[model samples]
Target: MTEPRFHGPDFAALEASDPEIAGIVLDELDRQRGGLQLIASENLTSPAGLAAQGSVLTNKYAEGYPGARYYGGCEVVDRAETIAIERAKALFGADHVNVQPHSGASANLAVYAAFAQPGDSVLAMSLPHGGHLTHGATVNFSGRWFTAVPYHVRKDTELIDYDEVRELALVHRPRIIVAGATAYSRELDFAAFRAIADEVGAILWVDAAHFIGLVAGKAIPSPVPYADVVSATTHKVLRGPRGGMLMCRAEHARAVDKAVFPFGQGGPMMHTIAAKAVAFGEAQTESYARYAAQVVANARTLSTSLVDAGMRAVSGGTDTHLILFDLQHLRIDGRTAEARCAAAGITLNKNAIPFDPAPPAVASGIRVGSAAVTTQGFDAEDMNAVGSLVARAVRAEAGTADGDRELAAVKDEVTTLVARKPAYPVI
Candidate 1:
């Protein structure tokens, strides 16, 4: 458990003996092991997943699906990918599974390629209204290829308005209807979205990248049954390798496979896929279901605690694993809050709230999430304490003279909180 600069060999020795890459890698590993990662899209993979990811399987190049690969030495990689695909299908209850895309955005792009051509219409959540870049942000490749028609939440409610979505569907009649979000709080109404898609002759594609682990735990409804295809990242709540997968009906299996293989990428990352299989297998257990439920409960507790601390949370609270706190309500800047929080040993991201008054980089809100802390074994009560410390820090910065002193106290509180919760247990 000794740090690199301590017990580990010198950088020059590693660079010469292994590769210059070894030095870069070990440095990153040191940073990750020491820092607090609160980003909602990130997680600590299990030991089994990590071991697979760091295995010699990475040396293999598996060009196709199991048993039908173009490569000569793909026998073991075939098993790894086949296991990953099967576990994904079983966990989500889908007829087909393709565990090849390198990232969530890639998975989404494959979905678009399978269903729509360039300039075809797509109904997706608005970016400012809790949408992802791939969902149709003008700067993204998805928007570059397709004309994106977006739906937003009610201005007053700060949550998705199904009535508005239905109206948009009626007017646009898009080729695909996407249901999922990056920042929105309340649970999505997948059934309502399915109905809208049916009326408009559109295919329902659910991107449950953020909440797949929750669905496995039964904390939320799974979209596999309601959608034509589902795309997700295995790393988030699923706690796997940094990769993506596609699940869909049997009819689209061939198209999905082609889209992910020859269409989206070349030889798959067999090592990561091997790691994903381990992660998916872990998700199939009773313990992982309990872990998934703990993620949501911790999120709610964090959201409620922030509200009590006088910060305005989007949709008033959270039903999933993330919460957006409006820092402007406390007369603070999201950028400043982010920097101060990190200095205080608390970690999270600065995110744009629905209809945020500020720009993207310097948003009006900070998003705090529970997935990482929950993985570290912090539960609801721990989140309550964490939330109060955040409120105190924000309020302190808003004041004069004594503010910096109070920030010190907040830092100590965070140190104590982590001491009680601790980081991930060593393998």
Candidate 2:
């Protein structure tokens, strides 16, 4: 609360002798807490999840899966992990679930290790066109270890072309087909993907990391029905800790479990697993469903507002929690917009629009989402203003020297708005 005190009493005393480094860390935390977090891949967890994450469970070493441990004092950790896995399986209707992958990418790696060998062909969505890095970007380990073939969306529509995906799958005949993405703005046709995987006898791995909460709330069709393997992060829309989980059919449970344990990783972080269970329990409520629905509504509202302001929103609008705005078309690069917004205390990420001409450092797009803002109780009206502020700033950034002054005013207004809506309330 107090700028996330980087040093405790003792450490503070030690650093008090020379407060420069400690002062810098404190300033950084103040900056983070002061800014509005609009990054789609991020979320603040519930108090219960936070409690579990910082609990005594961190003391134990649970080397193997539940019911099998390499050390003592893991009985409680086993229960925690079991509850997490069971709740997740029930939530997604999966035959098996593993709550130990350190991250979503690791979960994907475990699936690959379970189902295929090194250098095996794997099909995934293209990075620039809305695929995750783990789904075989050139710089990622997936592309290095496996033959990663990527498919993209239609250029004009900026939506996934099922026909193109099928054509690529058929031509590639991959060992595994990965569905889902990091920055796409439309609902995925999991059944269509299932059919393509079926035709090639390839396993379907769905990375529901970005939309697990919406899927759990039934706001979007759950990918579990069509996917052979599912990997997701505990945070994002899931509103849990920063970790990943994996689920699969019972037939592949042992293989997947082994791959995650001795093969992919060892000694699970029990505290994170405990946090996952807590968040999963929270995801089962009726209120969460309504929250999920509002997420979509807010996205649509925000996207519509931006488009009306003369910004091009890819695919016309969104069916999920994110909206990708092509800033290049507005004569503003994403990098400049991101800096300008950050100076105004708005914290969103710059991204590449599908098949963008710009480089990663200076992207052609800016992705805005409403999850964190919605958590702060901002509704459609707030999104409209937020959208307008964003659009104006980006446009002004192109040629005006007064963008900095205007952004500073926006930052003061945002801080005043945030002061009225507290993230945590007295329960």
Candidate 3:
């Protein structure tokens, strides 16, 4: 076969080759800049980071660790990957770092591969009660392949019950215990988890996908000292390319690396790794620390405003970038609230609050996040206004003239608010 030819890195070239895909890309960018993005799992990657993701490194096929790659001509990609790993280690104070897995779920899969055998008992938070699917929801691979034992929060406090965790650990004696959440708003007691894991002789794995950025910015406590291994996604509040990473103790470093490559995945995405490195460097700055602090402050203010407007915060309020709001008292459901917010130019997701009566599809609560908005330069006062807008939209009745007017007004205000700080101002 003849040597293949590749095009240069330019939007003009893409438009020239395939304007349809280019138009879709531009439209997505427009959509992002046009409205409020409140999804807890999303954030805008910086222009520099985006450039790295779109770099020529995408052509490389580095199938193994940096220096021991299976493919030839991996020298440049090796440098990028090494930089990513070192930067990540510094950012999280980790003993070893693997910048390979394609997503957070992928990283979790690797974690299982590294530490546990199929059918080994694993303990984690329950999915409907703020845990991630990989933490052992029945439908996920983790739950299907392993015996899953779950723990839940207290009904009154809506916080993780350490006593229950200890009881479960003593009974099940799982091979691994995961400590993390996707929808939880309060800080996790890593020390508590560590103690429980030690008692049970279980490996402590912390999925820091959602809050690792906060940890990197020093906005909250780090799980590095407590956890045997930690999994994270470079996106979310980390504001990098969409990919996964693993950090583990030096003793488990070899196992983690082998698990990510050959066992869990092949050829790493060198370009995304480069982008993660760029984001890691950015996260080390003072401005990013300030940004992380503002993210938490904004979420707290927004949660208080929602409570003032008659909605209830799941854990009273947030100490991080995310908040879970219960709409039960308003006699509304999460699905309806999600639709209303979307119609009013705001975007968020329906989520199940702890002990929610409604099913997952029509959840009793909605999950909101401040990372994207805070990155767009929203302060606490701006968050308060956003909270009012969200409340007005969600509380408005549908199929009524009065409700239509209310939603329209909120939509107008939302348009005005987002205009003040565009998601991608340079674009």
Top-TM-score candidate index: 3
Candidate 1 per-residue lDDT, tens place, 1-427, comes to: 8666534234476678888688677766544454445778888888778878977788998888899888898987888888988888888888999999999999999999899899989999999878999998889998888999988988898989899899988998899999998887778888999999999999999999998878878888999889999999999988898989899999999998999889889999998999999998999999999998999999888888888878888888888888888888677788888877776666778888888889989998988778878888887778888888887776676345587778777878776667665555463
lDDT at 2 for candidate 3? 79
Residue 76 miss distance in model 1 (angstroms)? 1.1
Candidate 2 per-residue lDDT over residues 273-295, each given as its tens digit: 99999988888889888888888
Candidate 3: which stretches are off by over 4 Å?
1-8
Clashing pairs in 1: none
How many Å off is the CA of 15 in candidate 1?
Answer: 8.4
Q: Once all C-alphas are superposed, what RMSD does model 1 give against the true structure?
A: 4.2
lDDT of 3 by residue, 1-427 (tens): 9775965488999999999999999999878888899999999999999999999989998898888988899998899988998888999999999999999999999999999999999999999999999988889999899999999989999999899999999999999999999999999999999999999899999999999999999999999999999999999999999999999999999999999889989999999999999999999999999999989889899999889988999979999999999999899999999998888889999999999999999999999999999999999889989999999999888668998889888989988898999999996
Q: Report the Cα lDDT for residue 403, model 1.
A: 75
By summed lDDT, the worst window of 10 consecutive residues in model 3 runs over 2-11
Listed in order, each prediction's TM-score against the native is: 0.92, 0.92, 0.97
> Backbone collision count in every prediction?
0, 0, 0
- Please say which candidate is ahead in lDDT: 2 or 3: 3
**What is the Cα-based TM-score of model 2?**
0.92
